[model samples]
Structure formats: C-alpha cells, structure tokens
Target: MKFLFKTDYEDDIRLFPHSGYLWTYGTLLVLIAAAPFVLSSYLISQLVFVSIYAIVGVALLILTGFTGQASLGHAAFLAIGAYTTAYLQQFGVPFPVYFLTAGLLTGIIGAIVGFPALRLHGIYLVIATISFALIVEEILARWESVTHGNEGLRVKTIQMLGTTVPRDSAGFYYLCMGVLIVVILGAINLLRSPTGRAFVAIRDSETAAKSMGINVSLYKVKSFAISAAITGLAGCLFAHKLTFISPEMFTLQLSIEFIMVILIGGAFSLHGAVLGAIFIVMVDPFLTFLKDDIPGAIANFSMLMGAGAERAAAIEKSTAAVASANGLKGAIYGFLIMAFILFEPLGLYGRWLKIKLFFQLFPLYKRATFKRQKIYVKSERNR
Candidate 1:
C-alpha cells in the first residue's frame, strides 16, 4: 500500500498525485499518439468516434455528475453545434472561428435551457429537457430554408492552415485527440477551482450550498453552459467525421446513449467518460454480431435437442424475429443501464478503483472497503 503525506495546499489540487499517475497517463498518451500508425483505418475511425463521444460525456459529467443537474435533451445541443458548423462552412469561415462559435452558441442555448430547469428536479427536469429536444428536432425538420429540412447538409473536407484535410487522414484524428486532451486538462483545472468546487457542493446538498452563500441557480446555469460548450466542440468533429448532417442523427436515442456512456463508464471520473465512449461505440458491432450469428446458433442448438426440422426452423425463425426487432437495441441498452445502476452504481471507474485496491492490499483487503450500505431514506427534496 502506498501512502502520501500531504505537506502543502498544492498537494490537494495537483494534477498528478504521484509518479504512478504520470507513468500511466504518459503511457496512455503515447499509445494515442501512435495509434494512427499502428491501427487499421476502420479502427482509427472508431477511435475518432470514441474521442467525440468522450468529449460529450465530459460535458454531461460537468452538468449531471459534478453539479447534479438532469438533462435528457443534450442531443439538441449536439445538433445545434453540428448544424452551426454545417451552416458556417458554407460561408468560408476558418475552422477555428466556426468551431469556437459552435461551442459558444451551444453554451448560450444551454444556459437558456438551464433557466427553465431551475424549478425542476429529478424526473421533471428530465421531461423538460426531453421536450426541449423534441422542439429542436421539429424546428430542424420544419426550418427548410437554413437546415435544408430532412434532406441533410453535406460537410466538405475541413480546411486547416489553408490545406484541405480529409476526414480519414491522420490530421483529423490528431485534431480530435488533441481536443480531447485539452478538454480533459481544462476540466481537471476547473474541478480544482472555486467554480468546480461550488458545483460539487450544490450536487451534494443544494440547501447546504445555499447556506454557504453559493448561488445555486447561477452555478447550475454556468455548469450547463460549460458542459454544453464542450459537447458542442465534439459536435463539430462529429459532423466532420460523418461528412453529413441531419436532424435524425441527433435524436433522443443518441442522447440516451450519452447518458449511458457516463453511467457505465464511471459517472464521476474523466476516465469514465473515455471508457463509456468505447463501450457505446462498440455496442453497434456487438448488436451486429447478435443479429448475424445468434439465429443460426439457435437453430443448431434446436437440432442437437432432437427437435423436428419444422420445429427447429420455427425456433430459429422466432429467435431471428426477436433479434430483428427495432426495439431490441434500445432494450439491451436499457437493461445494461439498469444492471449498472443496481450492481455497480459507481460505474466502470468505480469498479476499477476496487480492483486496484484489491491488488494493492492483497491479503489484507476487506470486501467492505468498497461495499455499499443498504440504506434507504424517504426524502422528497434534495439534501
């Protein structure tokens, strides 16, 4: 077991707690830098997706994790950022200008959304956000003049430093990786600052935060703006990656997946955001495997059980039917979300801490060190 005896105030907010963090984070950075050269193009593209989603996860982390605000319509912010980028591209704006503008616009919108959320909490907040998302979707569909309706907008290659950069090129991948790094660094600094600490206080107990003279409403709005800004930046890259933009792409389902990313990856940690992104991006491939292989396997199993040919065929057909349902994907996501809430409330990041502790403590470890208290309270309001 390693122990650190803090001797200075800087120790409390230092970026690297110890040398171990430097080694681990350094290795991770090195790998990210080398990935483009070693990985296949398809996998590289997936990494791009992961980076973008992870950015949004961090945004949600700021609002939902650190500040205890609930939003179910973050996809609206994403769509705004994406469409903003698409719209600006046609005007010949440089990448930096439009990119920052996308985030700024999204942040302003998020702050506006936060105003309505002030009186809401729990499920009500969720519903309000969902309504906002539906409104954005409808606007996107009806405002044919600018959005081009459901026909979508084509995103040409990005021009950086007066050079055309294709989506698959290493330049774009590095750009995303670089952005993720900057966002992570910025979030770390923010968490160590007064604003970040205020957010945490409000999350833990709004009433108590109010007692401390913290402006709960203002902080909540700030949190939303900051979170939305980060997500908007991610949207810029997302639009570029797909080379297309449409209202249908940023649906409620996508917003739910963002929630899933934070929940499953570790709601409280930046590391969780990256892990959640990987899991979310890979879900499609996993579902594809189920769709393509599971039915055939079921048929073979029925044959092994000595079922008649027609019965085996029927069994396979029914199994395929279940797998083919449009709702199956959503159902699986829902189940995973529920399971994580029930079994691992701390998420993948929490699980990681537990495992690391076990290794560190070895035979001296106790299960209760990471155990949850089965306590329930009947409270009608935030603590």
Candidate 2:
C-alpha cells in the first residue's frame, strides 16, 4: 500500500525502502527476542531448527536464485562442515577456530567444484551437483578413520568462550537466534553491494553479465564459495543439535529440502529463507496430523453420527492406510513444489505481495500487476 517516489540516488540504496519496513521488521525482531521466554522448551528447539534451516535456505538463494548457478550437492558442503567440526572437536579446538575452519574448508571445496561445473548448465548442472553429493557420501562412508564410517560421531555441547552450552538450553536458543540475525544482516548488505548486483546479472544472463564487463566465472565461483560457507556454518549447528554425524544424515533428500525451503519461502527473497525454514520445521507436525489425527477425527465424527462401529473402524483404517502410505509425505511435498512452480512461481513471499497489493488497490488492481512474462531470450534481463 506504500509508494516511494525516489528523488535522490541515495533512496535506491536505503536499507529499508519505506518506513513501514523498518517498523514491521523492528516488531518482528522484538517478537523473536521474546520467543524463548514465551514459548515452550520443545518449541524453542524448533525455533533453533528454523534458524539453522533458514541459514541454508539463504545460502541456496545466493547460489541458485541470485547467482543463476544451480546446485543439488549442498548437502555435501553441509556434511563437510559437520565432519570438520566433529573432527576438530577431537583436539579440543575452540568454537571460533572450528567454525571458521568448517566454513573455509567447505568454501574451498565448493570453489573446486564450481570451476568444472561452470561448463555445465540447467539439468546438467543439477546432475553434476548430485554426483558431487554422492561422491561426498561415499567418501564419508569409506573414510572410516576420519568420519567413523557408518557409525555416527557424537557432537558435544557448544563450546563458547570456554563455556559448555547445551543445545536445547535458552542460551543456545539465543546463540542460534543471534547467528541467524547476523547472517540475515550480512545477506542484506551483500545483496546491496556491487558483488551482489553482479550475482543478479549473472543469474539473469551469464553472456550479458560478461558482456557488461563482469567476471562471470570469478563471480560464479565466489557465489559458490559464499553459499557453501554459509551452509557450512549451518552444518555446525545442525550437527550439535542432532548430537550425531553420519553419511546418511546429509543425503540427497536433505539437500532437496534446502531447495524446498527456498522455493516455498520465495527463491529471490531473504525473508523467504526464514519463512521457508519455519514452514519446513512445522511440516512434521502437519504431516503427523494428516497421518494420525485426521483418521481419529473422522472416526469420532462417524461414531457420533450413530454409524456402526465396524463401518467407522473400517473408514478409519482405510483413511489411515492412505495417509500412512509410503512416500505420501514426499509425494505431498513434491506435489506442492510442482504446484508452486506451475501456478505460483514467485513463491509464498511473492503470493503475499500479490495479495497485499490486490487489497491495497481494491477494484483498481489488474490481474497483470504481478503477471509473469515469458523470456524469449535467456541473454535478456526480465528484472
């Protein structure tokens, strides 16, 4: 509902486009700060999970959404971080040292992978990344001396400035929240910088970005490193939260969930990452309701209506069977992803924008306000 008429070049570079953003985001921060105090301990842990996944979601957006480079092997980078931290812990390495090492190591590996991957695009690039993930999975399984093979490595509590912090404690919740805040701020600043602009350019068109004097190859590699580094930090938190590390933990499905986080959250938005994380974290409970609670509710209703016990029981059994069928959860998630791709490509955040704009414009709004345009040429910018 708000409009800004830019009169100066500085206006475009402002951190918040309008006063509304400042007020709304400020309110959000206050709520997040009070979450630990007001929410249950288990829910606080869920918040920690959301924070960690949000980090990974933002990283994926940096590479796939902004840089125009697609990746399916992000789980490998995540594994590298977890294993690096676990390995370093054996030597009693400090938190800062191990954390930095995890990020740097993953970044270097990502850079290595990005160079060869630059030659590939679209589905080929996806395949290449998935191949990388498979390779990392194999190495983790084979490298028994370092990764402990199939046996999981237990992660101890966080060692912060010499204090041991439990993962579920309020202090740890604060730590995770703090890290998420920093990462979001850093991402916001990055997107505002020239480097981030270059990423957007490359994503729109590598040939055009190169024509414009941007080092496409260099920026692409940098995007990979930056994205990988962010995911690495998430891995550290994820490992600690799970209290275990194994090759099976960082599977292709896990990497797909990271993509799901970005897709459902809004691939091109920083806020999307956080929203997607929240959605992903809450999905387990939702799936449980669908699988277990729905059947029970139906049974109760049927019995209340004086239906025979046999019929009610049969109905419940059939409903439970269908809901609990193997791959139903994945199928539902995949269907939703497909639906979004087909009907709401811009994602949840995009849908929110459209709805808000419709209400603001009332009868004046047109269907074309948020319509998607087909690109005839990949080298041309639609943004």
Candidate 3:
C-alpha cells in the first residue's frame, strides 16, 4: 500500500512537475533573449510595440479581468508612468530606479482609486474611474509648467548600469521584450497565488467572498495597485521607445482601445492579454498594407476619381488617415467580442483548448449525444 502511494506520488510529480513548466518557460525566455540578433529590424520593432501593449493589457486584465473591477481611467496610470519616466530622464536619474519609481507611483494611485470600489458597485465605480481619467487628462493638458501642455516632453536614450543602450530598433526591441517577459511572468505568478484567487473570489461575489472570511477590500485595492504597476512599467517603456511623451498619446481613445483588447482577448486570461495586444497593435499595419498592396476599388477609385492633382493629392494624403480613422479597429474588435460572446465567450484560448481536447480523443470524438454533450450544455445538466 505504501509503495502504491509512493508510485502515484512520483507519477503525479513527473507529469505535473514545476521543472516541466519552468523548462518550457525558460526555453521561451532564451528565445526572446536571443530574438534580436536573428529578427529583422522591422519585425523586431513590431515585437517591441507588442511587448509594450502586452504589458499594459496584462495590467488592465489583472484588474478588470480577474478582480472584476472596471477601470476606464487606466490611461491615467499610463500617464503617471510616462510623466514619471520623462521626469526622471530629464533629471538624469538611473534607468532601473526610474523604471521602478514609475511603477510604484502608479501603484499608489491605483490603490487610492480602488478604495472607492469598497463602497461603490458596477457602473458607479466605472463612472468614478472614468472621471479620474478625465481629470488626469485635464492635468496633463493644463499643467503647462510640468507636462509642457501638449508640447510634449522628450525622453533621452535609456541608460542601464552607466552604459547607454543603443536607440536603434533591435536594441530597443530586445530591451522591451526582456521587460515584457519579466512583467508577464510576474503576472502569471500573481494569478497562480492565493492573492490572485482572492481577487477572483471578490470579483465573482464580494459579499460571498467576505462571508468566507476573505479580506475583499484589501484584495481589491491590492489588485488595482498591481495592475497600475504593470501599466506603469509599460508606460515607462513607451516613453523610452517613442523618446517623447505627450497628453495626446495617453488619450481616452487609448483607454478604450486597452479595454477593447481585454474584451477581445478574453477577460481574465493572461494569454488573452497577449493575443489582444497583438491583434490591436498589428491591425493598423495589416490594414494599411491591404489598402496599398491589394489595389482594390477603395484605393484606385479614390485615387482616380479625385478632381485633379491638387484634389487627388489631398485625397491620396487623406487615404492613410481615413483608413486609420474609419474605426476598423473598433469594428473588428466589436465583431470579435460579439463572436466570442456568441460562439467562444471564453476567448481564443478557450477555443484552442476545445480543439486540443477534440484531437486528444480523436477516434472517440463523436457527435454530441443527448445524454453526453461535452462542448456546450447547461452546467447543471452536465452534472
């Protein structure tokens, strides 16, 4: 009997060991670490942008997705982070210190914001958060002395350990990717911990969670702080990447875009954060190419139909911006969200999981019988 127990324990340990996950994770880390040398400059830059967005998206997901706290003012945190990093750069602070400070400052702000959630519910809290965002914009735009009042602030090349990192695309990409990996892994760990579960419980039912002796208020606030911190890190990266900071960069549109990413990627899933970021950020370039390369009616008709070179040039000039502003990103995001809601509400990862399950039992994968419907059925019925 003892041998049987030991054998089962060994099997479980082998099958679901920490080393296995670590090995896979470490391998990924190595790839990301070495990606800069092999990847082209353009692709590297794209990946860097992806990393920045992923950081912010993950931050938002932790708060809204896992903690069930709706935050519309997340850009406020990003603003805080950007300004902080810019200030530090202007003042000649060390890179590591500046980065950490950015996160810490935003985290403090987020904790303060979370306090209202203790007393408010649903849209009430959402409104307050939105108001906070608007207030931040006002500050950024009006604080001419500090924020430069829409003139924007310049960010010098980020220096690490007294050595200036190259501002070239590849170096920047490597740096962003490295930061992204750290933040992502940290988020994953947080979600796997007791604190994360507490957030989830509070999100699902604060009253029930409280009844079960969970410190709902504390967790809610903590999640907000953590979420803000993650975004702040992203903001720091953004400032460094762009070498500029402006109120316009952290607009309400950006806040909405972040939320859209969360919705499209699947709320509360880390993988969703990544997938959403890639989708939102990549859509612009992809569509731009489709416009130029495809040579369809939309492109040629507009080009040829213009009254003359003056009008034609003007029309051609507007094409890029018009294509950009036509709300295709929003439309695609809305469609994706609706599709996920209707067909795969659990998001892309959920669909992938179902497909994997289908393949795992391929020969046994039969049509759903009235007695045994595996894909979709009432939870009560399944039991």
- TM-score of each predicted structure versus truth: 0.93, 0.95, 0.81
Poorest lDDT segment (10 consecutive residues) of candidate 2: 374-383
Which residue runs does candidate 1 get wrong by more than 4 Å? 293-324, 373-383
Candidate 2 per-residue lDDT, tens place, 196-245, comes to 99999998877798999999889988999999999999888888888899
**Tens digits of per-residue lDDT for model 1, 95-199:** 999999999999999898888789888888899999999999999998999999999999888998978879999899999999999999999999999999999
By lDDT, the candidates rank as: 1, 2, 3
Q: Please, what are the lDDT tens digits per residue for candidate 3 over residues 1-383?
A: 01223445445434225555678777977888778888877767778888888889899988899889888888889999999999877787898999999999999988888887677767777888888999998899899888898899988998877677765656677788878878877876787678987888988878889999998888988998999988998899888888888898887778887886777677768888888788778877887785675434445666666556566555666665656566876776677667766776666665565566678777775444212235654453322
Global fold similarity of model 3 (TM-score): 0.81
Q: Which candidate has the highest TM-score of all?
A: 2
Best by lDDT: 1
How much lDDT does each candidate structure score?
Answer: 0.92, 0.89, 0.79
Better of 2 and 3 by TM-score: 2
* Candidate 1, residue 344: lDDT: 92
Name the better of 1 and 2 by lDDT: 1
Question: In model 2, what is the error at residue 161, expressed in angstroms?
Answer: 3.0
> In every candidate, how many clashes are there?
0, 0, 0
